[model samples]
Target: MALLILTMVRTGEGSINSLGAGGLITLEERDTLIAFQDFSFDTDGWDRAIQENSLPGLGPVLDGSVDTAVERVFALPEETALATIRFDMFLNGGWGREDTIHIILGEIQTLALGWPSDNSELVTFARDGLSVLAQSALLDPIRDNHRVARYSVELAVSFPADRLTLRLVPELVDGAQSNWAIDNVSVVARGPEA
Candidate 1:
């Protein structure tokens, strides 16, 4: 299936109040739970470890020690036709801006996203087998214990697979200072239509 993802570049401009209205979805009784991680307790087997006192109000977040990739794998339901993975991307410290960001899913589906130009809209292109629908919330200040950008991301899945992998790959500027993390992640899917 064609993987779709998008996001805004700046904070509070075209924002949706992360974890508030238009935020992440709450799991209902009817839905099948795939996975959820907020990093409030532990890393929960994620490649990155939980960094305490990373940001205020947001207790702990996954701090990437390895520069390779921050990834998580989930067992998907083959019976379902679609799935939605929602989470937030924290661009912390003093990092340089990029022209684009990529979110890889299941190792096959990928969504390439671009930053907003002069307008309020976040830029994206239909590259390869990807599409975008941008939505973003507030960003943090670039300081110690501050996050430069926090984007609430949602990936719409349209195909079935034995399992799905979600990956956030970042190329660091000053690896020692500039950092990244993901929080309040959850995956939910719908069954095939009759």
Candidate 2:
């Protein structure tokens, strides 16, 4: 019995056991690339106005302090083992404690952080956690010396995600006093099948 148990246990992680002709066959799982966003030409596969509010003189970006947010629904297989989301994010104008962003992923959270038991995944980045950039890239001559910064952020998540809803919402502190942006986003999943 011990020999049989050890034989079954050494098939490697994410390997499926299949009974073949008088033997066991193991199937391996691999990563599946799912590129969700390419903001170079236009914004596709993303929610319209709500997901993005373009600045009058800027390239494609999701802009708004809190009132506007970016949301994308990814339809993946029900057996996805791992997922990674990547994006280039930035915040323009002044920001404070209230400028933190919330990342809510349905099933990606491994442990509960006192949020709702419904898997309320939460993560943040603001203030000192990013690199401040020059506002000259903003192109608007409205004023000078406004707090501006950008960061390339990524998150590792898990899912049996049939319908995955990923949302990035900034806290609404002073009601649209400042704006933010996100671009070059992508999501990759790994599983037994596509």
Candidate 3:
């Protein structure tokens, strides 16, 4: 498992603020270059509104205090390991263990692990201890059935690429409403795949 360093940054201001919020996770010695505020809908990069509403008891936003799930286009400086895109993600509301968040890399779709159907999944097996505790404590009673929690999953696929458009699709398998939030998304070069 590669080590990930999580850090948050903010740009612009208020709800209409562009770029909204973003995060960066360093992978040690790797050259990570990101243009701040590039994720704003106003810009040509990100496509969608940057959500700014407070997530009840979830405290401030995980990184930049701006929570949003929007599609964006990015180019890898070099060839990247499209097989696995890793990042920090959060899910809220009633979702089943089988329900997954779709990672669309260019045209490929990889179903990533998502929140469990029951709240007990957190207390029982402690799948994600910190995220579960944060979600359980900050979840609003009226908003959704359960609190919000964060998890990091490596989206497995075998596509190598120099540029890719990415989007996260939330599919509710159990006919329940759910929200997915993400931050610190990144793709690292894996050289030529033999």
What are the lDDT figures for the candidates, one per model?
0.56, 0.47, 0.43
Q: Candidate 2's residue-wise lDDT over 84-125, tens digit each?
A: 565545566555544566656653322111111221122443
Clashes (candidate 1) = 0
Q: lDDT of model 3 at residue 156?
A: 32
Overlapping backbone residue pairs in candidate 2 total 0
TM-score between candidate 1 and the true structure: 0.70
lDDT of 1 at 91: 56
Q: Pick by TM-score: which candidate is best?
A: 1
Which pairs, if any, clash in model 2? none
TM-score of 3: 0.52
For model 3, the stretches where C-alpha displacement exceeds 4 angstroms are: 1-24, 27-30, 35-44, 57-70, 78-85, 96-98, 117-145, 155-159, 187-194
- Cα deviation at 177, candidate 2, in Å, is 2.3
Residue 160 in candidate 2 has what lDDT?
Answer: 43
Would you list the clashing residue pairs of candidate 3?
19-40, 57-138, 83-157, 135-148
Instruction: Count clashing residue pairs per candidate.
Output: 0, 0, 4
Better candidate number, 1 or 2, judged by lDDT: 1
What's model 2's lDDT at 96?
A: 52
The ten-residue window of minimal lDDT in model 2 covers: 14-23
Indicate the TM-score of model 2. 0.56
